[model samples]
Target: MEAETVSKKWEGKVSAGLPIPTTAAQVWPFLEDFCNLHKWLPSVDTCYQVDGISGQPGMIRYCAATITASSTSSGRDETMIKWAKEKLLTIDPIKRCLSYEVLDNNVGLKSYVATMIVLPIDGDGIHGCKIEWSFVSDPIEGWRLEDWVSFLEPSLQSMAKNIQDALLLL
Candidate 1:
């Protein structure tokens, strides 16, 4: 009998950073609350805690994205909802970093883990911050590595813009 083999290679990995015209202190608060993703992430229609306490390791959040789909047969638009449950793996307030992994998702992502960090930056004496987001995952069906980057880059940019806009209003 021949022994079976398993491949342990990561199929997709991506990293992106967005600079916000604000301090890390301002940005960290928005990210620290695990259940508030809908506030800053444009694609998230709603996010809420499903298990455990917010901002703590082991906390799980259910995030949903609702989209309008064209129904050619009915000649109308229909609403579709996709969701993911993500669990907080680690959080370090002092370091301004957190990590999470997807527990369940309607999306095709598998073995997905992500980390987010807020770093302080100074540009010509303007106090600002940069948010670094990176992830690794098993290959998603019908998705290329470039597809992941394409999705993440714009999402992060929009998130940064939303957060900055909110902070400016405060």
Candidate 2:
């Protein structure tokens, strides 16, 4: 007898973008390294290259983050550490874009994929780029698009600021 397989459908999608006051060239350097996320994204505790090659498709990355107890509304009093293994699916430096999909994570989401793209704006060197992030996931129960947006916005907004500041010092 043959067995049947079940597939989970995506439940929600969240998209957010932030304008960075820097050129695409400047921002690309900050985002190119898959293992360097921890340096710019405040929420990431660490990111390490696991397999294949950096910036190439099939490369794997292990990322860790700490979820403070106070940040959760579940009334827990202890902090938690979350981690995930993600595989690089695509990368295009010329267009300043990259995409990755999560392979495994301690988080509740069953499926997740994200893409980041940078585009030029109408300004010069210090103010001419916008970084946009789009995420699609099959969220677990009790989660909504707004919840995902709220979870991602702070880190992305912080990353934009970090990129702008780093470029200004150059």
Candidate 3:
């Protein structure tokens, strides 16, 4: 009997950038923490370290995200919950970038890897920064590549706004 091969190649890619009113120095602090995604990602209700140490490679984080959709037929809103366990693959403080892979997820994302980078914006007297997020994953059931990009762009924008608002409070 022949053994079946499992392919782990990423089939879809999506990326987006959001301009933040704060500098990279400030943004890096938020992203480098590794277990505080719920602070900025509006849809993520909870995120915590599941294993290893925070901000270090080999660490894993468990996140629970919720999405509410209005149902016209039912005259109510439906809430969906997604859970994912992601492992930290790499961290580069000098470049203000980190990479992570999804080890397990209930959302049907397979072989998922994502990278986030905080880029400093200089010149024109602009002191803010931009957050660049990119990811690759295997094809998800009932979702197209464009759908993933569209969904993420707004999420990144919201996250940037949340970061800015949090900084203002400080």
User: For every model in order, what is the number of clashing pairs?
Assistant: 0, 0, 0
After superposing candidate 2 on the true structure, give the runs of residues whose Cα lies further than 4 Å from its correct spot: 1-21, 70-76, 123-127
Per-residue lDDT over 50-145 for candidate 3, one digit per residue giving the tens place of the 0 to 100 score: 999878999999999887889999999999899999999999998889999999988988888999988876633166778888887876778877
Q: Considering TM-score, where higher is better, how would the candidates rank from best to worst?
A: 1, 3, 2
Best by the TM-score measure = 1
Which segments of model 3 are wrong by more than 4 Å? 1-21, 69-78, 123-127
Model 1 alpha-carbon drift over 4 Å, by segment: 1-21, 71-76, 122-127
Q: How accurate locally, in lDDT, is each candidate?
A: 0.83, 0.77, 0.83
Cα distance off (Å), candidate 3, residue 164: 0.7
* Candidate 3 local lDDT, residue 144: 76
What is candidate 2's lDDT per residue for 1-170, written digit by digit as tens? 76755545553333323354457776877777888899988889999999998788999999999886663666667778899999999999888889889999888766788888777765454546777788777755686667777777777788888877777788
Q: Cα lDDT for residue 16, model 3? A: 35
**Which ten-residue region of model 1 has the weakest summed lDDT?**
9-18
Clashing pairs in 2: none
On TM-score, the stronger of 2 and 3 is: 3
lDDT, residue 60, candidate 1: 98
